[model samples]
Target: MKILDRYILKSFITTFATVFIILFFIFILQGVWLFIAELAGKDLGVWLVIKFLLFYSPKMIPLVLPLSILLASIMTFGSFAENYEFAAMKSSGISLGRAMRGLTIFIISLSIVAFIFANNVIPKAEYKFVNLRKNIIQRQPAMAIAAGQFNAIGDDFNIKVNKKDGEKGEQLTGVTIHKRKKGEEYATIIKAERGLLTSSESSNLLQLELFDGYYYEELKTKNVRDEKKMPFAKSTFSKQIMNIDLSMLNKNNMDEEQISQTNSMLNISELNYTLDSLQNSYTKETQSIHDNIVKRTTNTLSREISTSERDLSNLEKERDTLKKDKNNLLSLLTTSKKQRILDIATNNTTSNITIIKNSKAAQNERMKNINNHWLAFFEKFVIAYACILMFFIGAPLGAIIRKGGIGLPIVFAVIIFIIFHFINTFGKKLAQENGIPPFLGSWMSSFVLTPLAILLTYRATNDIGMINMDSIIHQITKPFQKLFKLKSNEE
Candidate 1:
């Protein structure tokens, strides 16, 4: 029995490793396909690209692990059943349950490891991956700017070019540059027939050398009377050089605290803390909204009372005097005054409505972020459970199908994984939009697969094959066979 357990465990481990590698490779290729635009023609170093991919691999583990487990389990169990190893074991009084006992323990352990990875390892990896991409983008800012597009540099310059050339993108043609200072209406525009871009790794300055260009400057006077005659200056030059600062752009330097605030970069406890803070903020914002509405409504309806001391008779006289004053004010109001009052009322109403709408929009955005944090919080556990559930499903399915190798098992595993992926993606989207409860949305895929896993396991344990299509086909063709025999006899 110990030997049997070891054999099965060894087989599963080998298959799991193979399947995981293949799946991991495929997912890496897919990621490459998705981000080739960012990577291509950049001349990034081999080590740099490798480091980027390495940082990115941890994020793919949650997506890849369950599929690999499903494929490996199916292939392993299917090969055993197809080769009649299960039958041989049963004949020797070893039940199917005994064969699965060792593998089940291994799978549960894998699930725990996966959970730990999601909690501890993946968040850090995600943080690194994001920062790596940011560094790459910052290192090659010229690659990000396309030809014939206005690319703003820092706060003071906008650069554009009609054509760019060379592998390193060192050559440029038909360059247009605009320079301006803060709070200035006029700008200095430079148009060149050709240009060259160069930068150094140690310095934060980007230098552009231009040839056969003209510089045009628009000067404005501070006086309003002189603005009608704005002065302009133009000069042609054979060659010129300009230095632009690149220090302000987000570089490789990032505060870990600020980046960790993102949901993807936070663990369960961090997410819960963030969620509590967001909920408090949300509550305070809502209370502020209520207070504003009540305050505005009260202010709109209330009128100031005159400070005075009076008895009952004095109060009656005062009321009569106020009524007379109101009548006199109404009489004094002109048509323009009435129109102005109506306009003021309209404007105030419009302002209040706009404020309410903006408040609701802000609240909705905050709620979406809250939902995202909750989803991330639940996702770690869900994916861990997914690994265990997928194994149960694949192992039982493989036994029932009795098909070995990658052929039928691959098809079944892919189909199940697609369903799982779709359900999970759709549920997350629905949860983000508040269409479903965050808990339900996060666990929807697991909820769906659990029952299917149970049913397949039950059928496999009872030695029942699911819906024999061969028997159904034979039954359908039997009537045709009898009709053909009757026709032949008559002939």
Candidate 2:
């Protein structure tokens, strides 16, 4: 390799390494801040905390790599242009494209590496990170209950404690438990002055022994009139013992539902498999809902529904028949029979409406989950392309701007990155809400920035200013120039 290419590559690598490390650390700190609640006051040791952060750090790569490359590109090239090194190279006939050859190859390789890391490393890291959180709760059940907050235990209980002491944080003070029963809200409440937790590893139940406590339970009566009195039972106890099940939290067994449920923990192949099952399930559920509606509204359409085999077009056609013979269809029926039919129709319609309202929410949620999987699938490529995109933009923009050393470069990088990030976020949100296709949502940022990169590269290659202000000024004054010329001619 020529000295110039080596020099350029060396400069960019040094700058990229420096910028990436700093930005990565900053983002990791941001992650730490975001989840500080889970880490702080849990009594997790320094080693465990460090391990947690280490597992989490890889997830920041998609954000950090592109921005770091952009900043580094701009800084290195801007420094080169500012110092007249580009001029020296241009004098020797080393075109900008030629100068970028080595770095371009390096960038292509880097983007591939980034994609691999995203597809492979990121998923594994996410799995570990999530499992670590659960493992902490598993090994130390007390860690699951944070002080000063109502920690929910499964679907049945919400327990809160003002303070927790002892080596394993088993001793509790000012404890409150809200027990949930079907068809009731805050149905049972247990409060204690002090409590102690004891759990057996072999058993899933964690025993809570409370002292100086009171128990209050809302009583329900089968008689509707008596229920209005709002009867409740209250009692005081010097010592109380309750067992809480921690099976799901500590089972160390994989739930098939949970395994298929998480998008972040799956690789591209796994995502494809999961998405297929999800789409099929969504379709089946949707058709099932339509069948239920059909069953409710029209007994005659049962044959049509069964024959159509998931197709509802024939049932829709029957709607027009009812509309066309609206009066004739009821004319042959007896008056009492007609009234009974009308009453049944009204009840069926109300039931169908309720079913539709409930099913709509479920369908939307299912569709959103599918969209998320697609988003995750496309995001890997988008981030990989972003590395190349940012390089094109930053390297050319740096040369055009002709300023160096993180002064103007930092400002430009930040503004451009913010725009990219905002557009990306907007697209993802829109896709999540089913406003747009997930493919488009994932690539929205790249699409918006690609043209800018092309324009910048074109300008830098031809040695044109970032903006042709002189041409704009001349055009703005052209009419006046012509007017003055006419006046001079008349004079």
Candidate 3:
């Protein structure tokens, strides 16, 4: 262990740790803001909030770790180069590779740690985080129903509101509720132009007060005549109140993770198994759907051909009658029969359209889920590779730029990271929509930046500037210079 190597490692580590802590905290604050809806009025204690943040912090590591390494590498090496430390090393016969050997080893070891953390630690954290949120929402039903898309209160009620106002978010607008009743003709639906959610005097109940709304219930009738009439009941209301039972909801077992199979909650091996099963399921369902659609579309084609033996005696007479009338096929049918045929065709077309529309939505959702799992599988490897990639680029770039201490070095690191992040996001989104393979999308940033890393390493090692300004200037002025010389010659 040479003193120089030790010094270099110490410097890099110091910068990396400082940058990591700052960035990690910043990102945590951003997380808090992003999930304020779940946190603000929930009465979750300080310790619970801290626990929630702690559970969420692990997921930020993949983003924070690489960027910290990049910025730290740039600052440390850039300071060394700016201070003529590289020149001193070069004078002492210590090459650039030798100077880098210590940091490279450290980075490789750190990348391995990153891989383990991403594979093992992050998934467990995600599972816990999801479950904790679920438990919190369960205990506080108002949090779930405050403002968002459809949120369930046990198995009975689904509540949604267009907007929420007031200090505790108890005030609501555009409220809609659906009550689930098994074996009923249809679930009772309650909609209100305005609504309020309030804690009931009884601890086991929550009061939902609705205004200017309608209650709709479709009646299930045993009588065939009444069923044929399709009876339903509707009532208009100025103000209505409902007491929702909360005793069953207060079971706060945070450790009981009901959702164990989310894509983010699985390790690489689990993801592989899940992905295979999903793909197989997708294939089987797709094939079944294809067969069903084919059977539906070819309903008329697959039928028995109605070849009837026409009376030979009447055939010539019928042909003569058709020739005399100059009639189309429609003219032969009665108007009532024609209308019935048209109605049947229209009904069949409408049914097929409905089936396709419904199938498309479900199939697309299934495909999106599969893509997300594949992305999760690939991302575990990506974070590890990204660490090495960022270091390689940043180290050499710093040495070349020879500027440090949060000036040009920060600019370079930010620009490069932005490009990387943007490309990575684009690829994942594309993959999610099935526009590209998840493998390609996940590693797209690495593939695009690998050559740049190589180029920077080559330039810095060989003592070349970022650009040969002399050559660029010569090329840019060559045509103008030639034109000026020609004019001078003509003069």
Q: Cα miss at 87, model 1 (Å)?
A: 1.4
Query: Order of candidates by lDDT, top first?
Result: 2, 3, 1
Candidate ordering by TM-score (highest first): 2, 1, 3
By summed lDDT, the worst window of 10 consecutive residues in model 1 runs over: 301-310
**Global lDDT scores for all candidate models:** 0.85, 0.87, 0.86
The candidate maximizing lDDT is 2
Q: In model 2, what are the clashing residue pairs, if there are any?
A: none
Top TM-score: which candidate number?
A: 2
Query: How far is each candidate from the true structure, as Cα RMSD in Å?
Result: 6.1, 9.3, 10.0
Comparing 1 and 2 by TM-score, which wins? 2
Compute the lDDT for candidate 3: 0.86
lDDT by residue (102-145, candidate 2, tens digit) is: 99999999999999999999998888888777677665677778
State the RMSD for candidate 1: 6.1
| Candidate 1 stretches greater than 4 Å from native | 139-169, 173-191, 214-236, 250-260, 304-348, 469-491
Q: Write the per-residue lDDT of candidate 1 for residues 1-491, one digit (tens) a residue.
A: 59999999999999999999988999999988988766776567798788778888899999899999999999999999989998998899887777889999999999999999999999888888887777665666676556767876668888888888987777889999999989988899999999989887677888889999999898677887676665778899999999888875544443322233489999988888999999999999999998997788567533222223235675666676668676544333456655766676677688889999999999999999999999999999987899999999999898888878989789989999999999999999999998998999999999999999999998988788896634675799999999999999999
> In candidate 2, where is summed lDDT lowest over 10 consecutive residues?
301-310
Candidate 2, residue 335: Cα displacement in angstroms equals 3.2
